[model samples]
Target: MIVLSEESQRTSGKDAQNMNITAGKAVAESVRTTLGPKGMDKMLVDSGGSVVVTNDGVTILKEMDIDHPAANMIVEVSETQEDEVGDGTTSAVVVAGELLDQAEELLDQDIHATTLAQGYRQAAEKAKEILEEDAIEVTEDDRETLVEIAQTAMTGKGAENSKDLLADLVVDAVLAVKDEDGIDTENVSVEKVVGSSIDQSELVEGVIVDKERVDENMPYAVEDANVALFDGAIEVKETEIDAEVNVTDPDQLQQFLDQEEEQLREMVDHLVDIGADVVFVGDGIDDMAQHYLAQEGILAVRRAKSDDLKRLARATGGRVVSNLEDIESDDLGFAGSVAQKDVGGDERIFVEDVEEAKSVTLILRGGTEHVVDEIERAIDDSLGVVRTTLLDGQVLPGGGAPEAELALQLRDFADSVGGREQLAVEAFADALEVIPRTLAENAGLDPIDSLVDLRSRHDGGEFGAGLDAYTGDVIDMEAEGVVEPLRVKTQAIESATEAAVMILRIDDVIAAGDLKGGGSDDDGDEPAGGPGGAGGMGGMGGMGGMGGAM
Candidate 1:
């Protein structure tokens, strides 16, 4: 048996639970103000003094460098929300913190951790049922509604002012890539360029290549283009292994050079023979080949990345050929036009108007790099929400509408499952109201008054009723065009409940003596026996168990 060191610290039972609950709550509080349309932005300054200013939940939490294990779990919840739906990250984190806060009260009332865990699991399942039952079905013909959904997700983001224009682009991009297999977001690429206003952002019917023509002498535009996608270089290949070619005679050396030149010419000839008016090569093109290609008036781009090549193939309806010898006219892809254009001091190739094109690009323009970056993030969230809505074929009202409805229903669910588990379920119902409450607080309204009014409206058979942060009134979110995909809300609920339960189940804390760091408490003090702190108690230090009863 290993001997216990005198410096080792242990805090078990109630002390451990309280510490974890406090840490989780503190983390929730940090992002609490950054909720809803009126939410405030956070400026994160790292040691290098590089600053990030945004209210995006995942971005803020990721930049915080959290040390407490319990708080980290809350961060993981936001990450999962972002990874799953790309929005509602703040809602998920806020809900999780509220769940822990509610659980702490139940724990103080002599409730067991296992009972709370079991009740939360049941409540989470019931939440899914309620959401599905209440979700509004959307079909392919509902373009206006889909645009509204996209606009809702983009509101309160950097691109909010351009929501109408950006929403159209997002919906069009999603619909273009939608297939029986589902929406392939990979098919939709967002390209950002600084110097233009946000309203100048537009969607390209085909892919935009950042690289320009390989040779200045090559044609800048090719109409009714037949494209060849070459996976290999258009140059003579070197021997796979080291070899010696002994040519003592000058004439023999000339013959060897002539053969190499001939091979390169044949490669270009093959592309021409296949009716390829434009060529996108995955590898380099020999200088002689470029010269020949330019002489033939064929446009060519060299050293295109693999992803670009695949996108080109999709946009042009062409197949990538590994060997030029196997190239055929039928193997070539077609585009209405391929042209090189100069933008922001850089040359960009535009492959547009392909028949039945499956890939597209959204070019985002802004006055500054920071504005463009935030615009991209905002558009990303909109794109993700639209994709999720199209894939699931269902959506719900936003602005805390679904959360309020779910809270009202879960309380009834709790009564039906009466027992020690009932309290946990009831606590979960109360926990969900945190969404509307926080929304109100962030909007500078009375949170308690907003929540009470929201519950009253929800109870009056108004399932879509939600707090209008701008007006500080409960209104129909659907009528206001505030909507989100069912998947986003469901994902937030599942991730938040699961994370809260996982943290609530902890009951013991044992820490190493030399640990000096732990998650910060409300006062910003490091908990005793934290990750790098000396042994002590309270805060996350009391919650961190050192290889014991995790």
Candidate 2:
């Protein structure tokens, strides 16, 4: 009966369940208002006074610094959604919260937790099926629809005003990186530059090296350039063991300096002989080597990031030479031009105008740093959704159209099971409506009126009809150019359900006991720090400690 320690604390049975459910619901409510295009933003200020203004569910949850375990689980739902498809994070967290609320109602009706979990699993599987059935066919050739998908992903975010430009850039980036294995969004990089407007953003045909030429005396620009990439440094070797030069005479010092100058000259002559006009090195450039390369009229950029070098190789069709001795003619990649330009008051070398580039970069320009940072987040989300759409080859109308359709279909499917489990399945169907309802509420429309109109449209067999957050009219989402990837909806349902079921099954929470010190005396009497000293049996009410209504 005294299995736990004295300082331990515990909540059990109905109290534990209610406590967990409330914590999950609280997390859901925190981000509820950040649900749609019209949804408000969350301004998070951390303990250090650093601020983040984003409606992005994962970002908000990450910055919230939540303490409760169950609330953290709900945050994981958003994180999972973002990792899987990069969109629908808000919808996933909201759906999970609503699922917890619905399960709480069933707990009041004496339904066992296992039964609710089983029914939820069944409902989640059917929901994915409904989403697949509702999916509209889309291909890479459907540029218009793909752009719409990107636009929908950035609709209410900071990039909405420039969504058209951003979406087009995103779709183009995805398409450029598409291969037989599908599109890898990692091949595209977004570089933000302040002091420019949004519309001035351009898609660079090659990677943008955030470094400048190693020496200012070298050429600032080169056209029709032959590029060389190195994975090692272009500096003189230092002795591994400690060695001292006995420079008792001036001739010995001159001999040492001449030897170093000769070594640097050889390296520069080697590059000039290779006809390499632009060079990127993975390590530092020695000052003497810099003088030599500058004299040779070669542009050498040192301390380049390894990832940028890889990307540069891919774009320029060049191989990264490991050493100067291993250099060959084929190791040099070709670029139309290599130039150093001042962007946002910082000098950056551009390896661009590549032919048939497999890796690309986006130069995102904004009037300010914060504006560009938020724009970068929006562009990243847009790129992910577009890539998901192309990979799945299917999309669904956005603006809660998919949720409304799935809710109706799930209800009819729930009726086919006719048992206590059926009630849970129906509850799931109702929870799915939270998407459209939240969308309505965020847009300041009457939730009841919007829900009614939406259900009537679905009931009348119009599967595409959904609430227009802009006009409060129930119109066809497909016609309104609102769309998202099929993966977004299915992934959200799966993640939300798993999180809800997991939280619902926890009926006990035992916090760790305090580690108390002090030992008993030599007698066989009660210990010095005995049960009465802290929380032995007192913590559990002597085995009858299901406090409150158990």
Candidate 3:
């Protein structure tokens, strides 16, 4: 019979629960202060001295390098929230920590983990229902409302100063890429370039090629461009198997070179015959072919990346042709203009004013690298919220309005399900108030007073009322133009509840011994009957020795 050794470390019941909850709360505390519009930023430095400064929840948690399995689960909650809604990551983590906190209190009162898990799951379902019922419908033509949603997302971020301009650009970019099927964010590209003011950022009606013209002799600009997307290289292809030609006479070698040149010339002749004014080649272009194309007054770009080629095809209404011999007039793309311009000592190609482009480009300009990066993060948040809004066609008031309303409704729901589970449900409701409380605290206001006022106002039929973290005043979020997509709140609640339940369900933890250096003391004294001692067994004998000694 196989016998288990008593020397193995095992933690169960209250000990395991306490340890997991402590680790989760510690992680939550690390990011709690970075919650609201007035939230402070965290500067994380790795062992190698690399630094990252931001208030983004997922970024901060991901950089922390958490070790505890339970804590990592909390981090996953934030990550899942960010992946699903693209915002409210901090709120999700904070709520999850609070749920565990409340669960600990219930555990002290002899409440089973299974009971707590069931209540939390039920509360999550009701919270999602509340969010959907409270959402305000928005139409595609509501440009003003859409702009407000974008501005609200960008507020208190690096892009606040230019939020109006950036919001307008974001709205236009989303609309430009929206089709009958749905909105595809991949079609809207955001390109960041430093050394310019933010106001200089503009939207291009087509794709922006980051490369320069292939030949210097080619025209700088081509109007009424007929673009051809070549997936193959312009150079002559060698045979599949290697073979060398031996020519004893110099005339035979010259003839071989002339034939290669003739092939390149004919390739260029084919392009000119098909009325191709510009070419975007996915592979290298031979020097001879470049010269011939330039001589024919054709614009060409070589070494285009596959992603850029795809975007070009979408913007120009063309297909990527793999074989040059199969090139036809129908395979070509139409563009109003294709030009090359030099900015900051770098050449960039612009394919602009396509006939009916489903893809658009937003060029972001800033004074420095750091500024541009922050702006990109801000714009990313804006774009995500806009896309969510367009897809769901529903939105909720921001600035903690949804949380306050949800809390009030959930309390009444708890009363209906009166039992031990009712206590857990009520705890879930109280946990949600963390959002507004943190917002108030971050804005330098009295959290207790703010919560009281918010609850009272919400109870008095002011469903849209929320704390304006900027001024610490209770105002109607809708009237103040503070709004967010309904999915953000719903996603946060669902993820936080699921994580809390998963952690609460754990009742036992068995940790394996460290196997790297073997079980030896710092004094270098081996126990009696250990592996090298009287017993012939190795590590297993050491375990028996430890049990006997203890």
Candidate 4:
């Protein structure tokens, strides 16, 4: 193994960590405005020239062509959020970014890097407690309210019917994937395939076929059929010599045709050997191939589209569609089957274990193709957000119950820790201010002393944290809760904390020249700013800064 000098190694590590912090914050900030009901919107065009306009965090992150490892890490946090909660990815990224930002500010004041890092960790712990302490009980009546909360997060981006549709779809997806473990809410699954337009969303007893019938004479239905969904073309190929043959005589041409017929018969035999009940071909079939299949009492449909094949595979849970192009081993996916039944008007239905089948087909309809396309996108975004929100353990009270409780707990926890660690812990407490600060800001309230007043009123045994002043009672939080998931409060705080720590660790900003001159030699320009520069690490472009230059 090659060994790096201690100084070189330290420099590399710091730069790597710094980049992660910087890129993460940039990605987080990009989606901040699209957070709540009052939040604005963003329209992004990806590198592929595809246009995406939405406030959804997952959509934003997914559409943004990001290459930085640090930025990708931030994306992963959103991914994890999507995977865990079915929503709140935007909030997580925003909070993480804000935490970094705040951390950077603390670092700039001659504070130790370690201290800021410790403070951030403590602050995060406190914030989590705050989230839990602030959680309000979710009641049956609030189910629609839960949906309203989800819709509020999704509105204005697209989906004119987001409130009604997202509520129903989100609930269905949640219930479908929800396990006995009290709703494994995070495992929201989505499958997308390009196919023909169908009617409004409905449960089909059998999978829908987007392929046109092979021929007018072919039977539209085959009862009690064992279906085989093939990814390969149901075509037979001419032998190289025969294909190139120049027929000088009619007799020679006849012989060549006979050989081709024999080859086609063999191909059909292969399908039979494999026990294919009803074969669905991915590409057009050759005349001879078709003739042989017909004679063999086999039902064959050709030119089946790829998307149709994928959807059918998922729906049937059968394996058969393997590579028809380039034939990579891993590209292979299974094709599922269902027993066939006659449906009038050129449509056919396949039912397999009627009682056991759980897959539902939502044949969404729209006035125009464009409307359908837009609606599909909206559904995808709603599904993504809902999935992320449900992934974690449970949502805390949205009306500020947990945050308030957490703030009190953190202060108590800090009081118990000893000496120097206590200072770091108290600083950590100060960091939690960013949460309520952000919530109030998004709620259209003054953020400055709002948190202070909230704490004051809550401590005084008042009915609620703050009075509306106009309402003369606790401010109504129903609308607030409905839009809470969309807020970037947690994200802002987290990002600031992260930024503060990253900047504080910067004792020096070394230039490329220093490293070439041999790591901190006596002749090296005195740490850029001198005296207060703090030795080798203190100089602008000094040993420490040089490490960062890369």
- Measured against the true structure, the TM-scores of the candidates, in listed sequence, are 0.92, 0.91, 0.90, 0.61
What is the clash count of model 4? 83
lDDT tens string, model 2, 426-446?
A: 999999999999999999999
Q: Per-residue alpha-carbon lDDT of model 3 for 140-218, expressed as tens digits?
A: 8999889998998787767889999999999999888888988877888888888879988888989988999989999
TM-score of 1: 0.92
Query: Which pairs of residues clash in candidate 2, taking residues 3 or more apart in a chain or in different chains?
Result: 6-535
Residue-wise C-alpha lDDT for candidate 4, range 112-225, written one tens digit per residue: 567667756666656655654554444433456456545644554445444566457655654454444544322332323324332334334335564444544445455545
Provide the overall lDDT of each model, using Cα atoms, as 2-decimal numbers.
0.84, 0.83, 0.83, 0.50
Q: Residue 154 of model 1: what lDDT?
A: 79
Which 10 consecutive positions of candidate 4 have the poorest summed lDDT? Answer: 531-540
Candidate order by lDDT, highest to lowest? 1, 2, 3, 4
lDDT of 4: 0.50
Q: Alpha carbon lDDT of residue 321, candidate 4?
A: 55
Residue 406, model 1, lDDT: 88
In order of TM-score, best first, we have 1, 2, 3, 4
**How much lDDT does candidate 3 score?**
0.83
Which 10-residue span in candidate 3 carries the lowest summed lDDT?
534-543
